[model samples]
Target: MTVIVRDLRTEDRDDAERFARSRHRALPHLLWTAEGTLHLLAHTPPAARRRALVAEADGEVIGTAQVDLVHDSPEPGQGCFTVYVAPERARRGAGTALVRACEEHLAAHGATKLFAWVLDAPAHRAFAERHGYRAARHAHFLRLDLTAATLPPLQPAPPGVQLRPAAGFADDPRPLFALDLETAADEPSDVESGSAGYQEWAASTWEHPMLDRELSMVALVDGVPAAFSLAHTDGRGRYATAMTGTARAFRGRGLAKLTKNASLHRARAAGVTEALTGNDGGNGPMLAVNSWLGYEIVATEVRYVRELG
Candidate 1:
């Protein structure tokens, strides 16, 4: 069978659907949707040089790759890509071909270091090693059965603190943006991510199509946005926490846990059955928090990196 790699057809719904299905099959704990994929393709900053690529074998979409530079990272020349093949279609050379295409595209865009995520499975690690990528830290995808698990009871807000839905900030989300900037800078990652301009964050994060503003919770201390738990939904009873963080001064007060717990309760009441989140293996505080919320690790992915000569 011959494998062909090419850029995704932005206007093709079938193409987008197939790509999203492949991703969900490969990493089911996280949310995936055709509309979200299309929105991402259209909203990505131009400086990122983002490309959504797919692999075809025998006229069927078998694998997919999203390639782009770490445009907002404090460090330059860093490229990132994630490739996943339908489990049944593995070893058809689709993964390899997609990787080659991603590397070529990123290198052309001046990327000197390429980072890829490989599932922790043995075969996946071997494939990455064969491509000259070395293993790095790993992250876990966690899942909670909102229908069965008993979420922690909501607690009264601490003095001067109030719980609010992210929707309340729709008229002016600048405060959330500022909070995101503060929290994102502190997130644990292999690459040091930095926030782009406010407009860029608005297009890529705040205004995202999957963002469920009503389900996303925020903790305000005396009218100041202190912590948040962002929610994203696929409209199919699947909900994922897009991000959860607390401001520097608000870290020890259990504000993150409070907002996230409230968000989960709201989501469950709204008919969301499955809630998903991902955390760095080194983020013990968050890992403990999710465990307390009854989330279990469903899958793990290792970060792999290679330096381009």
Candidate 2:
């Protein structure tokens, strides 16, 4: 039985479903759906040269890879390829084949540095090290059982601030875009970030099929978005905190917590059964916020870096 790696067929629904399921098994922290997987393939920035790949042996898909360049970063030539093989098929060289294929494709596209998210497990770390990757910053995968978790009681909006659904900005989402970009610029990360493209933001964010505007909540001060909790739902009771941040000027006022709490309550009201979010392990403030909101760490992953000359 030989395992071969190949590009994933974008139009094939079964392949996408299987890929998502395999990822779910490999890393339960992520909330991925077939549609979401397809969207990444269709919507990733062109400079990224992103591609989804599947590794098969005996006609069964056993591994998956999401390879792409970091197009949004100010620094160029940074790429990423996260490879995962189903536990049932490990040691079959499926992971190796997938990583090799991804690296070759990315290098062909002029990528100089590569990053991968590896689960914080001994074998996972060893695999990355064997491939010339070194562990960088760590991140936590948090989960909340909305069905049984005791969330903090919804608090009244502060004076001069109003809690509003993201739908309020449907006619014009530029405000949300501006708020997002500001928060992203201040976000904690190894790589410097910027978010200036309104058109790209619309295409990659506002118009995305998985984003749930109704469940998303924003804290408005004088009718302007000051902080927000971006929401994404998988059409299944699975809700994710895509982003929760406050504008720089709004920091230290508890607006982020306020907005996120509102979004969580709205998610529960909308029948979302599970709430999932991720935070950089170094981001103590946000982690504290999540803890106060009843989230518990479920899994952890470390970012691995590799430099190519």
Candidate 3:
């Protein structure tokens, strides 16, 4: 069977949906939807030079690749790409075709270093190694059964701290942006991410189709946003915490756990059956929080890097 690789036509709903379905089938641990796929393509900052590629087998979409420069990183000439092929469609050269196309695009735009996330299976690791990529950091995807798991009881906010939903910041989300920027800087990763500007965050995160402000919980200390848990829902009974963190000054106060627990409670009350999240393996604190919330490690992916000449 011949496989053809081409750029995704975001304007075509069928094509977008097919791409999303392929991603879900290939990596069920992550949350993805047709609308969310389109939003990423549409709202990606121009500086990232993002490209969404689809691999077609005969007339069906069988694989996808999200390729872009690490525009938010301080390092120059860095690019990141993740490729996923439907389970049934693996070993048909679809992945190779997609990677080749992605490399060519990134290389043409001056990317000297490339990073990819590959499943920790033998075959997946072998594929990356064969492509001259070396393993780097590791991360895990966790899932919680909101319908059955016994979540910790919600605790009242500490003195001088108030818990609220992210919706309260609708009129002005700059505070959330500030908190996100601070937390993201401290996240463990191979490539450091630069600040996410307010305008960019507004378009890509605050206005995202999957972001559910009402289910996202935030904790304020003396009327100042100190910790937050950002929630994303697929509108189909699935919920995921996209991000949860506390300001540097509020880290030791257990605000991260407090906000996330509140969000989970709200999600469960709203009939969300499953909850998902990912954490870098090196992030022990976050992993401990997820563990306490009854989230089990469902899958692991290894980050791989390749140096370009």
Between candidates 2 and 3, the one scoring higher on lDDT is 3
Candidate 2 similarity to native, TM-score: 0.96
Separately for all candidates shown, the number of backbone clashes (residues 3 or more apart, or on different chains) is 0, 0, 0
What TM-score does prediction 3 earn?
Answer: 0.99
For 127-173, candidate 3 gives per-residue lDDT tens digits of 99999999999999999998799999999889999999999999999
- Give RMSD to native, each candidate: 0.9, 1.3, 0.8
Residue-wise C-alpha lDDT for candidate 1, range 1-309, written one tens digit per residue: 999998889999888998899888877877889989998989998889999998988888889999999998779999999999989999999999999999999999999999999999999999999999999999999999998999989899999999999999989999999999999888789988676689988998998989999999999999999999999999999999999999999898999899999999999999999999999999998999899999999989999999999
Extract clashing residue pairs from model 1.
none
Candidate 2 lDDT tens digits, 66-126: 9987776788888888899989889999999998998898888888888898989999999
The runs of at least 3 residues in candidate 2 whose Cα sits more than 4 Å from the true structure, single-residue gaps closed, are: none
Model with the higher TM-score, candidate 1 or 3: 3
Task: Give me the displacement of residue 223 in model 3, in angstroms.
Answer: 0.5
lDDT of each: 0.93, 0.88, 0.94
The estimated TM-scores of all candidates read 0.98, 0.96, 0.99
